[model samples]
Target: MPKHVWITRGLAAIAVGGLLAATACKPGDGTSGAGGELDGVTLTVAAKWTGTEQKNFEEVLDGFEKDTGATVNYEATGEDTGAYLGPKIEAGEPPDIAALPQPGLVREYAEQGALKPLQGEAATALESNYTGYWRDLGSVDGEAYGVLLKAAHKSIIWYRPSAFDAAGVTPPETWDELVDTTSRTLSNAGITPFAMCGASGWTLTDWFENAYLSHAGPENYDKLADHEIPWTDDTVVQTLTTLSEVWGEDDMMKGGQKGAVQTAFPTCVSEVYGQEEAAMVFEGDFVGSSAAEAGATVGEDAVAFPFPAVGDKAPVVVGGDIAVAMTERKGVQELMAYLASPQAQSTWAGLGGYLSANSGVQPDAYADEFTQDLSATIVEAGENVRYDLSDQVPSRFGATEGRGMWSILQDLLRGSTDPEGAAKALEKAASEA
Candidate 1:
């Protein structure tokens, strides 16, 4: 996922009334003390958030502290959490709880016996607040080890509404229509149709994953993610060929293949907003914030539609954080339970820059109508949502640096590798990994 910039204006303040009505108890509803009821309980929580993100999170943590009378020490663990926490776990001094960003990493830690299973109130809270899809994402084998804290809808196309109106084009409903629409936008409107963020290899992988999920369906997607089906399988070949229809075209992309392969993710959104070099960019909802940062008005100048269907139905690919526990202390369990509740999720949602999969949370909890609509779309998808396939796989085969999908797909974007060749290379990489 790209680095996110939150829109803080017009956010609703924390609604203690709503929180009280939604949950069984406020942290220290009846208890009274200097530290409240949970006095002297200090939890060490870690995550990959820093700066603005960390500050925003602390606001929510502060609410928890006031309600429960417990203190939380938050540590910004950076992106490579495995490396950061491995030594701590080895030394038997892991944080009480950690907000892991990757479901794959959570599963890895669970299998290594480095995590505690959610039980009693925490388990019940998760089961009540989240959907089956979200709960399943946090589970490894048959037990729940983590709980999802935030979610991103990845199957979306962010476009300039004015550009679409100028081109006299409505968002396409099918893959064939999308191709035709792109051609018409280029020819009639005289604007580049799509901004391909090839410089950021993850964006390219997202393109392939969405197409593959729509065409091959969810079962095949799962098989591919688990490597039960090799990347050289026909499904992968078909997906790459489908992607190449647009990606291979010389004029369909902003700067052609060369320019696209050099354009970074932020630049891709800016091209659609600031430069007006392209009409649309395919990415997650996070692009809306990026567009806003570049001086484009979200929900007006920039808007999005669900990615057009490639087969029978459009698939929603999701990226999110999964909160996992490192210890089994009672306070740690309480904190995990709180984080899984609608109250905790709603507080963060009201602060902007956050989206929760907690079904119990009201749509209006979001900062703006646009974000509320995005939340509704995710709810509409329901069980149809799929975790990002690349992120679900091992990093060696899925991540950017070195010989992963990033390098392989960049070659495809440069027209240096055909669909078949790319499939073969992907299979080889997976096998080696």
Candidate 2:
């Protein structure tokens, strides 16, 4: 991510909470302070989770610490965790385990043999709790290396139901219908149909991913993600061209394209719920909490629907934190198994703003009915679910600012790059990366 962008998204998340403070995490099993299974073992774990996320994660880790009488230390990696761990790995010192949202990084470290294969109880826990797509996501070749600890459903669009009612519009089920709703809401309701978060390039990446996944279908989406196909493929251009229906229109977005390119992501969400500056915003399920913070009453004041399919199947693009064991120490293996369990995941899911890919976790683990339904939609998708494509590709290609897909698509929103031009630029960056 760009420095400014990370300062905005990554830093902001970690601001309100400490590391759950490493020292505060260890001591007793309550049963046998010095005699539990992992007694005398000390483990180091790292991830970008902080504030409420950090506190919630701590509840899970605290469970493990209490059950096994092990000493566990937490490290907050802030942004660019790969950068933070690279030198440590080079020095032959790596955390016992690390939680990463990027599957690409898991693949990179596992291929380099820096991460240990998760097997035995850990593998069983993973297999029982998750589906094939998640299994594939956390594996390198045929070996399991990580467990998806939490997930965010990114294939959702947020809007005010009253706004749609005022415009006489319904939740769209197909791409053409979605574009028409955009037009209807603007023409009849006189409100901007979309709150485009162009400044935070990753949001634009999500926009392209949902469209691409639906238009190209999962097989091609996977092929493109793995670089088995070129970005200049016809599907890439077609998806971009399809998106142009909205982007190409001057009045389709609040604040117009130029203004959107300067609007931060939080502002984009707030514009709809807080200021009523726009009628809709599309992104991850996290938008729900952000909207609630802006004083929207969730299912009543704010509503979301799956991003409409361009072809047949609606896309379910997820971004999740994968817990990768950097060492196969006994304590690390035990912790890995525990992290994959329903007992561990449910502890966090109940905290709100958190979702789990673990099927063993019941919907009621979520805080409310709306969240429960959304969580069910994601879990029920099973092997059909797709990991966020940008999250799976190399970061320089997936995440860089003013370069790669981020810049290409940002230019698309600005009307500075046509579909073909965007395709060419994407191919160039993917090849270089």
Candidate 3:
């Protein structure tokens, strides 16, 4: 799962005040020029990554700075996230550049005029460089407010290759087969077939959306995001119902109902590596990195498949980060260009194995066979690669609907709510939103 960092109120106030000051001043602004450009300068960039993730970017940024003679003052947001930066941002002390994990943050800053909109050369360069989903997610009301830095693959179905081979089982082709296979495997091995943890509110919601992507197909999913389809639609109900049955049942999941509510999604990944208690985990491709960080091998020990479809549809999920610029610093623009460059994409994939939005870089070079196969699924998926529904919708609606999902899912698992009741609650939440 991706981590979302938030800005502190003090930072937000500072950011707002700075923007107001910048807006009020003339071409040659208060303390800087209107464009805020300066040659041979350094610009700060804050993000959630530290250690390996930070090194992955810094190594790439080093080349950019060396080539352009621009200095990059990189700040690791660390585990604490953007909470530390919000106050500085609100008070107009934001870094010249920052990468927000969620698109809603981009929308909020862009709508409030806290971000610098990319136009002309930069916008055209971006449009010509990334996928349509990347372009769309970074824009607010049709203007580009951010750039797609990199993407994480979210539609992978990971299984223990050796376990599946020993069980004489093959990946399922459809949703029904998937459910059936899950049950059969569990019954035969006397182990839970699926490893799912719903402790974190959004992690549980991912299961709903991933299942929806396979069942409803990408076109219909997009319709939901656009508010063209009602949440009360049969597809929505069916998807939630299917999820409840699988998640609510005992032995069907690695941990029982009690375990589901307590296990962090990342921790439950352990059930898949040589643990008969849990056999498969549906997660993003980058999950393998977490697995490795937890001392699991990538290619030999684990493998992946696309989340099986309900019928014949392919699956895709939102895979990119929205990075916004706060100032018009010359070095910052140069750094942004390099960050979105093909070289950076290659380095990111090589280091972290996440997909890149850069058109010039391909995943096959460094990605393992499973990663390669996953990329093929993504390409074959094409426009079916629906943007993450939660990120596409207004933030408030996402929060409300997400909480409703958590509450309803917990109730269904505990037998406090029936499928119909859960569906009705979700429908109500969606409708009210």
Best by TM-score: 1
What lDDT would each prediction earn against the true structure?
0.80, 0.80, 0.64
Deviating ranges (above 4 Å) for candidate 2? 1-35
* Model 2 pairs whose backbones collide: none
TM accuracy, model 2 = 0.90
Error of 2 at 280 (Å): 0.6
Q: What lDDT score goes with residue 402 in model 2?
A: 76
lDDT per residue for candidate 2 within 302-346, as digits (tens), equals 878778888887888999899999986768877888888777777
Ranking by lDDT: 1, 2, 3
How far does residue 109 in candidate 1 sit from its true spot (Å)?
A: 0.6
Each prediction's RMSD to truth: 5.4, 8.5, 10.6
lDDT of 1 by residue, 252-314 (tens): 888899999998898899999988888889999889779998889877788777777898888
Error of 2 at 125 (Å): 0.7
TM-score of 1: 0.91
Better of 1 and 2 by TM-score: 1
Clashes of each: 0, 0, 20
